[model samples]
Target: MEISVFSIQKSKADNFENEIKEYIKMSSKFAKISDLTIFNEKIAKAQSAGSESALKSYDDIYEPNLKGFCIALDEKGEKLDSIQFAKILESNSQISFFIGGAYGLSQNFKQKVDKIISLSPLTMAHKIAKLVLFEQIFRALCINANHPYHK
Candidate 1:
């Protein structure tokens, strides 16, 4: 399986970098995983313009990547347990997870994706959110393989 996490954030050194890499390394045992951080002048400019503009920019950037079982992480989306998340992985060989920018994903973008899930209702920094998502992905892969790590 190949898993890709696409998040709208500036790529830089972060405190969570080491742990995030560890999860990716661990998950490598199960699937090929890549973390793609996207941030350009257009996105930056739109962010300062306002929430609606920022969301539109997010949708414009992320729309092209919506393929092969896409899932968007949004606060208003459905809340799923680990087992349920694992069930999603069971049937798909390729999965792409979209994490929006400061204003979150737009309604149009959410509708374009196959599924939308909320990691938490509370807001979190992008780095922390990425770390949590990586960990859950590792756990879900373990569950699918019956590797005992999920327990």
Candidate 2:
């Protein structure tokens, strides 16, 4: 299976970047992994036009030829614990996650995704949120492998 995460954020702190890379390295053992950081500047320009417009551009790239489930980290989305998350990954051959810009994804974007998930009820910066999401994904991998890293 392949896992890809698409996100919009400014550059991360070095520590955050390093840690995320480490997690991805560890998670790569379980599946093919990739991450795309959609820079804030591009989204800013798109936001000037409107979030929906920016999201449409994203859809143009990722929406078509989708071979697996698509998920978005959304505040109003459903919640799933580590075990359930691992199950989601194991069940799919390809998965993509979208983390929108500061303003959040539009309803149109949310509706298009296969699942919308909430990491927490509280809001967070997109950069930091990416770290948290990566960690959870790593944890899920550990759980799936019956590794002690999850606990």
Best by TM-score: 1
Worst lDDT run of 10 residues, candidate 1, spans 9-18
What are the lDDT figures for the candidates, one per model? Answer: 0.91, 0.79
Clashing pairs in model 1? Answer: none
> lDDT tens digits, residues 7-113, model 1?
99876587387898899999998999998889999999999999989999999899988878999998788999999999999899999999989998998888889
**Against the hidden reference, what TM-scores do the models get?**
0.95, 0.86
Q: Which ten residues in a row have the lowest lDDT in candidate 2?
A: 58-67
- Candidate 1 lDDT: 0.91
Cα lDDT tens digits for candidate 2, 1-151: 7898887665655528888888889998887878777665555677679767777655554555344799989887898999999998878889999887756777776788889999988887777788899999989888888999977
Which regions of candidate 1 fall more than 4 Å away from where they truly are? Answer: none
Error of 1 at 38 (Å): 0.2
